[model samples]
Target: MAKIVIREELKPKRVIALMSGTSCDSIDAGLCDVFPDLSCKLISGINYEYPEHIKSKIFQIFSGDATIKDICQINFAIGQCFSDACKVLISEFGKPDFISSHGQTIYHYPFDERIDNISLKSTLQIGESAVIAENTGCDVISNFREADIAAGGQGAPLVCFADEKWFHNKNIAIQNIGGMSNVTVVSDSCETFGFDTGPGNVLIDYCMQKFFNKPYDRDGKIGFSGKICDSFLDCLMQDEYYYKNPPKTTGREYFTKQYIENALKFAPQNPEDIIATLTALTAKTIASAYERFVYPNVGINEVVVGGGGAYNPFLMKLLRTYIPKHIELKKHEDYGISSNFKEVMAFAVLGYCTYYNIPNNLPSCTGAKHRVVLGKITKHV
Candidate 1:
């Protein structure tokens, strides 16, 4: 190991932040100008699709069908995928001061599950930083969750740190409907907090593929065409994850294929109806989570929606229907933020904090015992 020096000056840094969310659809790479104040401006962004073969392997691991050798090999393999994504940005924008890679989260177990007296509150994100550093000839910061988990946090909904910094003073909920939905409540009345609201597009996307052989319900058209089964929606709303208090998180590990298959038993027979019901489930859970956790504590003035769900007009329509009429509904673009790359920009801020040795995790949101700088640096050398 080599001694690493933290940056002392408050200078702006150009960073290329790379990540692939729970969707595992594409590797999102964003080039940003991160300022000393931790504010970031996205200079450019790209969605680099994963090679079909590599993507299949990731799904295999998610389904618990892969061997240890497969996991070991895919770490570097996905690192190469991330590096390739960075190269696309680097070719046009040039090499950044450093690269921040969130890698790909294969599994996140922020639970109280114990094994042989060992608390298994852990997470695993696989793209190898050393491979990225070596291939790109640039310093890389990866594994942003371990430190927070070490501090007794759930190691998730981490975007709240950036949400607090970016939307401070505004009484709003930055709701991201990614593969799974999560919200960061930035308010003036109470401390910033957030958690996974519930399933986002995961179930809908799965059902779309299973029923229509499509990747997702574009503009939520399929969902709009069908009627929502309220009986089934009620059953889904009773999911235990929605009832759990905040400072919590979940991923595909909990909402696995098996879980989805079991859920389908209660679903409507029509595929479109199932899709519509699942979309409503996403919207309803988000609204219900707020009614339970946020509305009581914070007087939210607006709900700014982002991620793939924002593009789903039907989902947005359902959200508007379920959420209170008094509160305004807006998109990330309204605030000059890219819905697709906002998470990428958030990691850019986290990496910048790491470079300057600043504590980046928000304790209130993650339930960490304290603040901690959240990434590991892999130097190009």
Candidate 2:
């Protein structure tokens, strides 16, 4: 490789990041002022739900039934949503220096696939950068995962790049229980490693949508009303993904709607029990991950959780029960960041890193061959 030097005289700037995680529930925008010291102040955050029609189309495509034409259309369709979000966020919080769009992850296939002659691994997160750049009238950064995957990595659980910055001194575990749960163990020495722990809100939300006809378990009320089925919990515990080593990632592909349906059948046909069991499973899997990978090696003393699960009290209660007594559990907000907006904020930081030619993808966490600058930048001409 040829030598290339990045000028180190860049100034701190305001960045607006837009994200739609595996949940496919909504697009969230966060305006962040990122400083040289790696500190970020969230100027503002706004949430926008996808129109039911667009959401249905996206989900249908996710199910693998959509044609290539559908993928092409939704790629820009989602970008329009992101562009609109950026326009609104700029209006409310003033225009940022740049827009960092994490876009919508339609599919994340992390495993190795061998084709005709060679082995390949890829991950896709789509939101057309040109659309964002044109609509928002600013530079845009998107597709942050492809570089890591190109270097033979899982291309996921990428937030540790920002998590280690947040807890540089403490032996902390930052867990984001979004559609899928992922854990990042950041040590006092700045050694950070992470992986997908397993299913997070995805399963529980399925239970709620199926049984209660609600989008999610409000404060995990349904779970609180029911008792956990030990048998079902044990059955879930035996799943191979939990035992698989780190440097791994999973998505809706494995834990599909059918998986949830099958799990409910294994239980005693009570909606509450099913949800409670799913909640317990999420907590236990996280605790198991800590016990197996993090605790023995890093001696982590704190578990700071974020994502939608942070708002579910019963799920938090289950987490408290399953995690060790020596480790204190707290929400990301307890540390001065809003739980709902942290991911988008992290992307802002990642975008900042990319613009400055700084390496943002942590090899220790993503299992990449080496650290690399992430994100593809689209400059407005």
- Please name the candidate that would achieve the greatest lDDT relative to the true structure: 1
lDDT of 1 by residue, 42-85 (tens): 99999999999999999999999999999999999999999999
Candidate 2 has its poorest 10 consecutive residues by lDDT at 1-10
Tens-digit lDDT string for candidate 2 (259-376): 7777766886788988899999999999998888777788888899999899999999999999989889999999999999999989999999988888889988888998788899
- Distance from true position, residue 233, model 2, in Å? 0.8
What global local distance difference test value does model 2 have?
0.88
Could you tally the backbone clashes for each prediction?
Answer: 0, 0
True lDDT of residue 373, candidate 2: 85
- State residue 329's C-alpha deviation in candidate 1, in Å: 0.4
Which ten-residue region of model 1 has the weakest summed lDDT? 1-10
Against the reference, the lDDT scores of all candidates come to: 0.93, 0.88
Q: List candidate 2 stretches off by more than 4 Å.
A: 1-4
What TM-score does structure 2 among the candidates reach? 0.97
